[model samples]
Target: MLRRLELLKELLLLIPLGKVTTYSSLASLLGTHPRAVGAMLARNEDLVVYPCHRVVMSDGRLGGYALGKEFKRRLLELEGVKFCGPERVCKESVVDLKELLS
Candidate 1:
């Protein structure tokens, strides 16, 4: 794996199985920029193992996925983490990551 992706793997493992995380969150934890996380995910090769679906927008927007937004939604749907409330905020807990936490 590339250096960035290797770090991304470790960061991904920090995400809970049934919860959704964000690119920004992962980037912060990895001590990189949010765009860097997005770039790394854009190149993700093993979807079934890494479960990239567990990553989404911070506001529960579902954002973009390697395959497509529909894929992202479908993936999360399978994980049982639904968006709720007026804002459609996800009920699943997201680890609040800081830019310098790493």
Candidate 2:
């Protein structure tokens, strides 16, 4: 379980600046459930190093963060991620899962 968590954290690093990915996307690539991906992100201890905030919901909704959802949103905003609405991220800011696999 620890090893799986470690691997998930490493995957979080693959998310580029100003871009985001969905929990389902990460799960699809990791061969795990989307809830498992969210669980691993919630357990991340070092937000600066792991950057779990870059992971959102499949529909571009900002999901929960260890700190807070708004804080997570703000962090992404600082990275230049544009929000399409109050809590929805712009679709173009999302990174394609296939791109991350390569």
Candidate 3:
């Protein structure tokens, strides 16, 4: 289980700057529940290396962030992610899970 969580963090590194993936997307890749992905993300201690902020909800919602949603939004914005609303990320900024598998 610990190893899987570590793998999840490692996967986060694959998300490019200005792009985002969803908890469900990572869960599908890992054969785990999306909640498990969220749980592992909550425990992430090394934000710089893990880049957990790039993960969002399937509907493009910001979801939870260890550093607070606003900070996460700021970070994503700095990376050129455009929001569709106050909390939803623009769909164009989302990366498909298939892109990560390769």
Model 3, 25-76: lDDT tens digits are 9998888999999998999889888899999999999999988999999999
lDDT of each: 0.69, 0.88, 0.91
- Which lDDT tens digits does candidate 1 get at residues 74-93? 66667676767423337454
TM-score of each: 0.78, 0.93, 0.94
Which residue pairs overlap in candidate 3's backbone?
A: none
Stretches of candidate 1 exceeding 4 Å from the true structure = 85-93, 97-102
Model 2 bad stretches (over 4 Å): none
Ordered list by TM-score, greatest first: 3, 2, 1
Pairs of residues clashing in candidate 2: none
lDDT score of residue 83 within candidate 1: 64
The sequence of per-residue lDDT tens digits that candidate 2 reaches over residues 1-102 is 787787788788888999999999888877889999998888788988988899999999998997888898889999999999989999999997667688
The most accurate candidate by TM-score is 3
Model 3 residue-pair collision total: 0
